[model samples]
Target: MKILVVDDDPNILELVSIQLNQAGYTVQKATNGFQAMELLEEELPDLAIVDVMMPGMDGYTLTRKIRAYADIPVLLLTAKGELEDKEKGFLAGSDDYVVKPFEPKELLYRINAILRRYDKAVDVFIQAGPLKINRQSYEVSVGKKVLLLPLKEFELLSVLASKVNTVFTRDMLIERIWGYDYEGDEQTLNVHIKRVRGKLENLTGEVTIATVRGVGYKLEVASI
Candidate 1:
């Protein structure tokens, strides 16, 4: 998972970044909210840990801006521990909160808990003919065998499989899989989707990835 830490204090930023990175997450840092916005142009992290106190464009404002178009989780890392402050943070749209002077362990726990809530049961195998997909593990299976998938390919398939038959435009796929802040090209996502289809060749479905003329693609649903 990727995490973005936004804090003006160099010490806190470095500490959080190092801790999360040690915890097995790719950590990105920004000294201010503006820098955070700039980083969004590259890619939106799985979650954001923002400090409430900053020089300009505080955590609250950044939280709101990110929430406007993305569902990526947000956690406030602030020194203020008052109930009202917490409420304001929630109002600004954060999935969770962590007080400053906190143990990195606590932050890790919260992050894990939040991720668990979003994690779907991949044990629920989805199948249409010879093809099968494990939703929980994000694994694609053919017959009794499961296929290994790269991260982006798996994510792309996850998005399509989760919404079978929904004709999602390339732009929509870009946003859903990459998030509103993704700086990547839609064509790259298209390529990944096509690659995923290449793996589903054994399935009897015709163009499981259905193209909608000038629109985009949809994962064709099986009939009852």
Candidate 2:
């Protein structure tokens, strides 16, 4: 696996690169976000380890830029460990956030987890009512119509559709979709659910995302 490491601090950048190399990953080093984007154009890496504070473009902006095109997982490595900082990192599309001065072992663990979670399934597809979700292709369809959804929305739908009428708690959904260490609040989950619900409504009436009173949500398929 190739990992792009971006940081303004040469020592820290070198440190991360060495760690990644020692772990059997090819390392691409960039001092700033602009350089990172340039490197991305040359060849996209499997994952990116970005520093939050940089000269021209911060990690958050760089993360957004990467998400605009590539679907690779991103891990934000920075000194900002506050709740709001972590939330911002996630909002910007980072797969995980690790505070600076982090342990090399933990960093590798998080990277592995993110990659595993994002890896495409071999042969998994779900059929709920009129909708068909293909995990391998990351495609959602109803009848002859295909819906292009954002990654998070697709993942949320996929999980719910996997078990029709199964209620998944907000915490459970958040942990499954987002990382367990995700610092974002329930509002983030709710917003994604709302967006997914709206998209599903447009696609099919037979399939619905039902909100349990105090529990969570369930995907319901109307009987034919």
Candidate 3:
């Protein structure tokens, strides 16, 4: 998952970025709200960590602006611990508020909590005919048989299964699975797709991954 951290203090930004990166999250840094806005224009992060106080366009304003454009969750990081400040943060569209001088572990806890809530709202079990995918568990099954997939293969399968019958361009899959900054070519994706196909073939013939010629690929389920 990716997280954008917006803070005027260079120290805080570095600290938070380090902590989040250590926790296996992709971290983006912005010195202030304007930078954060620019980054958002490029790509939306899974969540945003914004400081409540900044020079121009404080966290509250940034949060409101983010809410206007995207449903991305925001966690307000500030020194304000009073009830009113937290209320203001929520009013401004922050999903959670954390006072400064926080333990790294506590901050991570809050981040995970917000992400879990967001995932529950957006990610769920997907079913196509006899095939079933549990997003939370990273498990794929066909009827009574469960298939184990590698991380990349599972992610690739998840993306394809998420939208059954909808052709996903190779570029789209690369961006979604490998990330916008992926430096690899289509061959990498093709290899993973081949692996996913091999696994699925072992389970059931009802579900198939179809190549769309020069276009891309799609998950197709045969009518029983």
Candidate 4:
């Protein structure tokens, strides 16, 4: 597997490359997000490990930009270990996140987990009653028509729809969707949820993405 590792720090770039190479994967290095973008244009890597802090473009912007075209799995690296940072990464588009000073084995394990998750079947179109979610296609439809959605909206809905009625704490949502280093933007999650709810209002009357008061949100499956 060809893995692209993006980090501004030379030590991290060298160390991560060495570790991935030792693990028997081909490694590519990018010192910043722009360099990573250039590499991406030339080679579509199997996986990407990106740092949150960079010179030209930050990890979140890079993730968002790349996610526009490809859904190739992404693992984020950040020194800022906060729920908000984790949420930001998820909102920007990331598969997983890890903190700085992390164990190489742990990072390897997270990569394995991400790859395994991809191996499992996740139907893009999850239809139940009036709602349908296209996980791979990133489209959502209700009743007879399909609605356009932004990347964050689609990703947030995808996470919620995967398991109905399961309440996700803000932190879990951040970790599962945004990645670990994600910064605060519950408001980001809130806005997208509100937008998704508005789109589904005709079918369900109210929001299918349920807010748990002070906690987080859940996907309320409508019974037919």
Q: lDDT for every model?
A: 0.75, 0.86, 0.85, 0.78
In model 3, where is the ten-residue run with the lowest total lDDT?
112-121
User: With candidate 4 superimposed using the best TM-score fit, by how many Å does residue 1's alpha carbon deviate from the native?
Assistant: 0.6
Against the hidden true structure, what lDDT does model 3 obtain? 0.85
State residue 176's C-alpha deviation in candidate 3, in Å.
21
lDDT of 4 by residue, 103-201 (tens): 987887687568547633545467655677777676677766777687767767776776577676665566556665667776766777788787677
TM-score for each candidate, following the candidate numbering: 0.58, 0.55, 0.62, 0.54
At residue 8, candidate 2 shows an lDDT of: 97
Ranking, TM-score, top scorer first: 3, 1, 2, 4
Extract clashing residue pairs from model 2: none
Candidates 3 and 4 compared by TM-score, better number: 3
Lowest lDDT 10-mer window, candidate 4? Answer: 115-124
Candidate 1 ranges beyond 4 A from true positions: 121-224
Quote the lDDT for 84 in model 1: 95
Error of 3 at 159 (Å): 13
Over 179-206, each residue of candidate 3 has an lDDT whose tens digit, in order, gives 6567988999989989888888899988
Pull out the clashing pairs in model 1.
121-136, 122-135, 122-136
lDDT for each residue of candidate 2 in 126-203, tens digit (9 for 90 to 100): 888889998878889998999988999998898788768877667557766886678989999899999999998899
Candidate order by lDDT, highest to lowest?
2, 3, 4, 1
lDDT of 3 at 133: 85
